[model samples]
Target: MSPLVIAGASRGVGLELARLARSGGRPVVALVRPGSDSSELRHLGVEVVAGDALSRADADRLFGSLPAGCDAVSTLSGLAGDGRRADDEGNINLVDAAAASGLTGRFLLITSIGCGEMAPYRSERAIAAFGAAVDAKTRAEEHLRGSGLAWTILRPGGLRTAPATGNGILSADPEMHGFINRADVAQLALRALRDPSTRDQAFAVVDRAEARSVNAIDPHPLLALGA
Candidate 1:
């Protein structure tokens, strides 16, 4: 299989996904910001490419040279720091570059629940604190949907630092909300990458016990990972 290229692998869901992919014996490459410490990613045997996803030139360089048929995943976000959110321009550039590369494999984007149709379900306070991020991610989601590449968008609910509970699941419902372990989300993402049935679909992901609804569009991938 072509290497799975992951952007924002310096930490959080992206780092966890890189760990899982390497553990599964899949070749991995990580695109992280310049000057960010990438010791962990390098330790995982991932080819660590130091580049800011926020730069269109950097994004283009990374995606343009990928081997044909390579899959990609992006967990880029700008919620924690200053300046423009990679959640918008960064993701858009990546999507555009991927489309330009003529890649035939899937491109998976890991966004969040407050985006798109689930916006109404977010608490007012939460929105007050993160409204800008939500909007940036929403724009990123829109760009990917129109990119023409085979793509899957996983909008994970509130993220948790807890270990994977094996209860995380994907729901087609627009109003689903809950907290899920980042590890579980990573597992689900890998499953989505391998399952062609999930292509061109955006699903809300959360732990079953915490979710308000259980209208999972596909049961197979959820159960495939022992969920």
Candidate 2:
């Protein structure tokens, strides 16, 4: 098996994914921005590279020297505070690098729900609250879609730090929105990577408890809300 490359493995969902991948006996290489708390990732025996997500130079530096036979890649990076947006630029840089390398196997991106055409399904207030970030991520998703790499985009809703919910499920329906534990999201991502059926598909993932059913979410509301 090839070593899995994880960007933003310093903390949160990225860290959990790295831990899970390592525990499964897969070699793990992590890309962390300089000065982030990567002690846990290092303790997990993950090879860490320091680089900025939005910097093409950093992407070149990291991807150029990536370990041989590197095939799988996952990104859980996003922005905080009010910088116009990093989600689109940062993730696009990675996607571009991966596509240009001609060595990537499966690529998974941990994006949020309500991006792209699904934006209108969210309440106007929710969209307004997170619109900029959502728009940025939508562009990132589009970039990946066109990058010509085998890819899967996992859009999990309202992330929570609670213990594993044990009911995470993937839905093809775009109308659904709810919360999912980070652990469960990582589990699903692992599944997606190994499941050849998931290639090139984008799925809405949520805890079954919260999402209930695909039809539970009404996409019609988005028509009035507008993108």
Candidate 3:
């Protein structure tokens, strides 16, 4: 099997994705920041690479080390608090790195809900504080859309670390709101990588039960247009 490069595989959804990829017997190059602890990833039989995804040189080194035709690349990089520019720079670098490496088969990006939209003040504030991050993600999505690659952008709702219930709702529009487990989101991300049906589209993920019960119209067509 081809190696899978997982950026930001230190914890949360990125960690779970690395775990799943390793469990499936795929070689994994787990990317983590310099000086970051990666004992967990190391324990999972992954090759750890210390580099910031925001740096072109680091991204180049990481991807260049991989075989020309690797299986997939998934990014779970995000910034908390007010460092949006840093986050965006990092994500954009990763996207550019992936493109430069010619690894375009399956690109999975984990973004958040309420990204790139103007709603109430509360929502706007929430977005503006991390506006740089959201804007970066939106642009990253746009780049991937035009990159002529098979990609899947997963915009998950409020991420929680609760135990997995093995179910969640997937919406293309942010009109519906809810929360989803980080583990569940990881599962969905891996699914998107392997499932061709999810190609070239952006979808929001929530608890599956909630998705089924929601009254919002499907946003698949709209998402397809962006593809």
Most accurate candidate by TM-score: 1
- Rank ordering of all candidates by lDDT, starting from the highest: 1, 2, 3
Per-residue lDDT over 37-133 for candidate 2, one digit per residue giving the tens place of the 0 to 100 score: 8889889999999888688788767777765457555554456455635678888888888777775588888788887768768788887788778
Find the candidate with the highest lDDT and give its number.
1
Instruction: For candidate 3, write residues 120-177 as lDDT tens digits.
Output: 2125666667666666677767776776666778877778887767776567665666
Model 3 off-target regions past 4 Å? Answer: 74-86, 116-122, 128-130, 210-214, 217-227
Clashing pairs in 1: none
Question: Which is the winner by TM-score between candidate 1 and candidate 3?
Answer: 1
Rank candidates by TM-score, best first.
1, 2, 3
Superposition TM-score, candidate 3 onto the true structure: 0.83
Candidate 1 TM-score, true structure as reference: 0.92
Taking the candidates one at a time, how many backbone clashes does each contain? 0, 0, 4
